[model samples]
Target chain A: MKKILIGIIVVLLLAGCSGGEQVQSKPQDQGYVFNYNGIPIVVNTDVEPVLKELGEPLDYFEAESCAFQGLDKTYYYSGFELTTYPKDNTDYISSVYFMDDSVSTAEGIYIGSSVDDVLEAYGEDYTGGENAYIYTKGDSSLIIITENDEVISITYQALVEGLN
Target chain B: MKKILINITCIVLAVLFLAFLQKLFMPKYMSSIYEGNLIEEYYDSDKDHDVIFIGDCEVFSNVSPIVLWEKYGITSYIRGSAQQLVWQSYYLFEETLKYEKPDVVVFNVLAMKYNEPQKEAYNRLTLDGMKLSKSKIDAIRASMLEEESLITYLFPILRYHSRWSELTWEDFRYLFNKRKVSHNGYLMRSDTKPVTVVPEGRKLPDYSFGENAWYYLDKMTKLARENGIELMLIKSPSIYPYWYEEWDEQIAQYAKENDLLYVNFLPLADQMNIDYSKDTYDGGLHMNLAGAEKFTAYLGKILKENYNLEDRRGDTKLAAVWQDKVEFYEWMKQDQAMEMEKYGYLKSYGAAAQAIIN
Candidate 1:
């Protein structure tokens, strides 16, 4: 009986401690994943493998990261842009931005789509003002900007834990 | 009665031991990542300044208070840190008003983009060195992330307890006495990594600033007015992170409505003789010592003409104090130049030094 009581107390202590654990979403989680040429591009994951799969980009730019010792690189594609942040000498995908209406999100929402279309596609589970709508799944967020009831920009961003 | 006295003595010793451990575990910021020590360095200053520059790394790495004093006889100090949020800047400004009231307060608008709390590491860099006060407490409350707790900041050992395994010689050496890192809150880097390719700003989903950021900015403006100080807004000349036209318009509109002086230095870089090829340290993000000198010289002239600030160099007492500062500034410049010449990179500043120590 005493052993069981001690076991319960230990379990309780662990459960209490687990309250502070942050939920960092993994790429395999049920978040929005952008597919390019049959290769799945996931934010917050290694960008090298995806780059290898996607082939060469139209243009590439890199700069020394702010307040840290690493390079922030961006790869421009035909319809979208892939940006990465450096950590431990490895580049991780931080965001993917759509440049034009040629490409749409996996949910069929693209630039020029009406606000009502976005509400129907992603549903009412969003947060933001009339100018922007943010749909978050785990730590990844799908940000959409609208002007005059038409979508103007679409971006998929990985919500990094620390300074980005 | 004897038992009770012994118990009390034991409790007191335990408390003292924990306090000592707390001091030991906290980062000394003596060697590398010197920006973390910028806040505490201000407490040791004379607190007599005509201008106070406040914001994130944009102000600390870009502007030089030493240059302002040497060239224009305008006394100034930069209360800046790495990725300092707008609310933290507001609280820091509130705290500064308690020590001294400057004629003008220049705020960099780069930090306005961040509406919520950023990294815990950055919060520590901005808040850890601050003395215990109401402003510090409020800043902690305003800046705490989801994983952060008030008690952890109150007793930093609670948060840094894991650092017991990572304690270094510098941590022990500077546990009691910390080395001065910044000159009037301006961290100097002599090396230059000139701008090669300037990247354009990405299309944002929303160009409008968050309500939380605006709330703090409004508070800052009102606080400056209440204290009888002129609030000047500036967008430092950082080529990256793309300051969009829409963002600039909003700030311009705000400045116009508030009747504040808003200067966007990115466009005026050429006018100020800021050559990106020779001026910047880490590409085009921040200015090296040479770049900072040029910018400060130009800014000092405008400040003098606009605010009618008197050149305080004529005052013998002020000149003597600044004389020591100028000498220290020159010494550090020479020291950095020698380091760059010998090692081809800074051995005492930035991540290279940290890597060597580790």
Candidate 2:
């Protein structure tokens, strides 16, 4: 009777361990929702949020160094292109881009969409030339480029000065 | 007599051993880190170039000197490396002028974006292979990152000493010499990774090139002008870095003020017959062989018509030299194609698995 009781308890513990694994399963990519501080790294957010999320970048180029790359301060992160600006003693993200497709926007803008898909997703509030499409919403904008009718790159930028 | 003989023998052997060690310790740039080999290869050249290009990889990977020579009879070389800074170019031009006086010196405008020193790794790629001189010394001083030291640049053994354990057969085989890694200064990629995505340039808070960068451009312009060398500034047609209007305006203004010719090729992609989807090797960051040939052919016409460059194909000595280069170029083209087919990535050419993955 004692042996039978012990085996029953062992089976119960094994069942309990696996039952927890199934509930804890989550998506492999969490949609690249990187936050710097608590600002969510969205448009109109300051640079502090980036430091909050990623802490200090591994390397940085000053404004003079970055002027050649057409950036102010190009911050190197793990698989992220983050640029920031300083105005009135405050730092804020000027632009953010990803070379990979794992990251996406809430509106579903991604690396391989068509020119028409962009207009449909973001509405017609866009201005473009032969090679570019700039979709503006308030002070935030999504710059998309389409080559051969396929969206090749997408970037997010805030259209405000670093400091007021 | 015996003591004197032994001492002399010891001195000779020690010099030879140090020479061997120096060769081993230097970057092979053969299997991997191809950019590292680029600047050093110029030393092996006959140094008989008519036009010498100095800039970043955009100039090296985009333009073909063999094609220029074959089609235009213009002997040219590109002294380009990865992320070559403005001061680095200024210094490289200074170094190149010491060897041969090329009538035309081309500066790729892409490097104008960088005014200050970039990464130490990139600095080493551009500066290390250079034969030690005042130019090399200046380049080291201007390009060194804060953590880098001049001593290491002077004696590369100290910088690369850690690589002792990671040495491979390439080091042993090329101890005395190196394989001709470039045709003139062009690193070839016969394979294609089409531009699937055209990235838009983000608006910058400030679009002007930095004052220090302008300082180098002024120095370059002044140097070229003083030397009576015609300087042509070109913006190659790699689409991903996204050449901006603001930057273009500034470059154009600078060109006009200096009475220099500046060609922004991004707008002329249509005229060049450049199909980004088919032409680029690394998704528009660089051009493959087909793209490079087309760009070179078009630019050669401009060089012939506008720059009044001589076509030297009829010169027997030059022809003999070029024929050898053409043979090597064909062999590399075939080799790269075979490697691509066999490995799906450039395995033999040292393309890391990450090369295709990204």
TM-scores of all predicted structures: 0.89, 0.69
- Write the residue-wise lDDT of candidate 2 on A53-140 in tens digits: 6776766643211111122456766545677754334555667775556665666767788878888887776686665787666566
Model 2 chain B poorest ten-residue lDDT run: B349-358
lDDT of 1 by residue, B1-358 (tens): 9987876776676667778987998888777778878898999999999999999878898899998998889999999987788999999999999999999999999888988886666777888878999999999999988877777678776666656779999988999988788899998988988887665666666678989999999999999999999999999887866888999999999999999999999999989999999998877888889988888888888888888888899999999999999999999999999999999989987632111111
| lDDT tens digits by residue: candidate 1, A1-164 | 34554564344334423222332222445467888667888787899999998888988777665523477788988889998876666788888898898888888898999999999999998998767899998657998989899998888888776534
Candidate 1: what is its chain A TM-score? 0.79
lDDT of 2 by residue, B1-358 (tens): 9987876776676556545665687667677667677898898889988899999878888999999998989999999887788998999999998898898998999877776775555676788889999999998998875556687677665565545677889888887777777888898887877765443465343457888899999999999999999898999987756688888889999899999988888888889999888897767777889999989888888878878989999999989999999999999999998988888877766421110000
Best by TM-score: 1
The docking category that best describes candidate 1 is: acceptable
Over 4 Å off, model 1: A1-30, A64-69, A87-89, A101-104, A107-125, A131-133, A146-151, A162-164, B1-5, B351-358
Q: Which ten residues in a row have the lowest lDDT in candidate 2 chain A?
A: A22-31
- How far off is each candidate at the interface, as Cα RMSD in Å? 7.2, 22.5
Quality of candidate 1 docking, DockQ: 0.25
RMSD of each: 4.6, 16.6
- Model 2 error, position B197 (Å): 1.8
